[model samples]
Target: MTGATTLFTGRITRRSMSGLIIAVLLVTPLEAFAYDNPIVTGTVPLRAGLLLLILLGLRTTRITAVEAGQLFLAQALLSMATWSVLLDFDPNRIAVQTLAYGTILPVCTLLIAPKATRRRWAFLVFCVTLYPAVVRLTPENLGLLAQVIATLLVHGASVAALDTHADRAELAGEMADIDPLTGLLNRRAALNELARGVDRSADDQRSAAIVLLDLDHFKQLNDTLGHEAGDDTLRHVAHVLAAFVRPTDHVCRWGGEEFLVVLPDADEALAIDMAERLRLRLVDVGVTASFGVAEVEAADTVTSWVRRADDAMYVAKHEGRNTVHVARRTDRLTVERPGALGAP
Candidate 1:
């Protein structure tokens, strides 16, 4: 779900940027005629065309938010430099241009970095300071001091507001990925992580594994102990699983009483050992779970890999619950050990 939201946000941002580029292209011809400036009449159209091409590249590519923000900032700076050089830094023209971009550029900076850090603040200060210095360097341009100062204040305020907004957006995205009951990642987020792990394992030629577990006779426990007890049991199990996994591992509630753990850079042996330990831990806490371990294969898709693990888990249940089983490469599961709670 978080991935989908990010993709949607990226599409919206790209479309908005494309629209801005098209608007700029349409306005350039008018500017050339209205101003009758040889540079605008001759060179601006070519620059606009180049910008349009860059916008098209943006449409065809996948880039991070920071990268896109940096690209936009680079183009803005290039445009400013072009105006400064071609028009001989005419104070009136440069001042007007600088003020026009003051807000837009700072907002772009927010895209590059939304965190409130000293380095980021320093960069913004440099940008805000540059235009005023240029305007004030020419004695006659001193008359625009009030306008420059106002622009600086406005830019400062906007940065604070924009950074706060970005923080909230990031927090919301994170919250959307979490399970309200277990405080673990939900199924969608888990599947995304598993897909990434599979791709990484395939690309790097490294091993990865997954452990799928389901509470044994959870329906009987809920029926006997009530729904509140079931909720507490789920939360307790989630906490135990989360605490046992390594920092690099991803633990997720795959729904109901089932949990999935993605172990990147781990082989079959390590996965089985981890599963045994986890099962023992649950038993120590007066609960039992069935665990299935499956190592990622060379040609394995996320779906196939998870299905193997799920198949192994059901095999454990069929053999008697609270057992551990390992899925063979050929899609068969062999029971490793009888569960502590077997046949009860």
Candidate 2:
């Protein structure tokens, strides 16, 4: 799924944020003019009010976590400034402040993260669920009715622009996460995929596994033959790894001389056996690597499990290399255990 990810729309949220800051900076004169001239109260304030509404809309429609994260940061800055400037901020005077500030901390959380966690998405879900109640509670004659209506319309426009941007950003991100050399998934892309898989498994009641591979004596090959030959060796090994992975599964270059395989629906025993086969297949492919296998437990997360798998691979390296070691679970999983080749 992460073979290609879009970077960011750079449209709705970024543009909106910029426009808001600009309008807010430029509107002091308007605010003063409106304050002095009673006749121009309705008309003169329109531009500033319209700009604020548009900004709100832009903030509302972001789809990516990074965008969400940046938005939250922007809100925090805006919120603090607004609070400090106002002599007595009240619902009547700054009614939407409640919505503006309340949404900031959580939505800011969403934007800071590259991927949305269950809790973060829950916040969005809450907003979605509570929208009907929001409409019901605020009637047409409510405080700042005109401003709220304008804000809603702006929100709609921003959302439309946001969807367009998200589609592109996801694609850009995926592209960035690819290993340019061998067309394999890069570490970032793989991590994202594995995390997503764990989420899916949790939601659907399934299983998954992660295998780590390290090419034994790979440094020797580079030292003796040349870096070019070593690269060719790695590429060839990548070809073997690609063949072993299921269409649904994925393989990634987990940095120098290391590869990670994400296997969905494979348990500990089965994953260990699969690792043995993968280890042997490298021999057939004319390159060899020490193998370490780790399974995703009911309680495991992508980060913890990957670290465990990496630890197991190191154990395999320590035990004379060229073997497979399955990560054992203790109170704390330490891949520092003695390595041994086992049943395939």
Candidate 3:
């Protein structure tokens, strides 16, 4: 199968798994309570079914884990009310319900709650579960409360550890894709983004361009002002490039003294305008860069597109540094200098 087809299939499978988990969680309580009392078998399923429908409808709101925990507590309370009103509260039945809730509710909370709110939800569950026992204060009820507290602590700790590990892994992935010197996207990340841009431009039939920038006389600057000055210059240029571009655009440090900007849905004119603006922006920071712009073509690969921009940038350098040069469809060059109305 094609990669796109495989990706679609994988998404469907994941969504199916999520739905199955919810279905199991909804039905498990009904099954557990059914065996305890015959009337519960009839009433619990109806209540759980209605609750599931409500939750399903509210799924679009992106409910948080803490809210999910609270909902579960509400369900438990409703069950208790049913037992008390219809059948008269039996101590043995209440104990059984509490034991079931202590085990299941914490596990559900751990699965859904965000890391920031996980402990809070756990504490809320503990307090809610102990409310019934607190009212009576008998020895056996106190023992039940203790069991619930222990269950929550053990499960909460496990969830917190898992969340910490996941966060570390995510941070490591981000660090790998970032340029340590300039704090811009590194070369690998830039290339990956370009590939995605290419696909999107093709599918949508929209224009896109890549700009290649090289700081003019960078080595001379480094020798005259020291490497520390060179580093500061690069950081300043990176900041200017990032700030000037739209959020939809991407700026990356493509190795020493070089940067690449990917502009989606932009034509050659728009690309040249952006490049010139960037060249002007850096003058305030005591550096100048040569820019080359190339619009996407039907025959272009990622390598070819970048190569075209690179060739145009060299043309800008040859025309006396600190200018914008655009690579035309016919492979000819159009050079734009400061204060010029049209490229010559």
| Top candidate (TM-score) | 1
List clash counts for every candidate, in order. Answer: 0, 20, 0
Model 3 agreement with the true structure over 269-344: per-residue lDDT tens digits: 8888888888888877678888999998877889888888887887888787789888876664454432342221
| Displacement of the residue 128 alpha carbon in candidate 3, Å | 12
lDDT of 1 by residue, 22-81 (tens): 766687677667557777677777777776666767665455334554565676667666
Off by over 4 Å in 3: 1-158, 204-207, 332-344
State residue 86's C-alpha deviation in candidate 2, in Å.
Answer: 65
Worst 10 residues of 3 by lDDT: 1-10
Deviation of model 2 at 53, angstroms: 41
Models ranked on TM-score: 1, 3, 2
**Candidate 1 has which clashing residue pairs, if any?**
none
The TM-scores, one per candidate, come to 0.58, 0.49, 0.56
Off by over 4 Å in 2: 1-171, 331-344
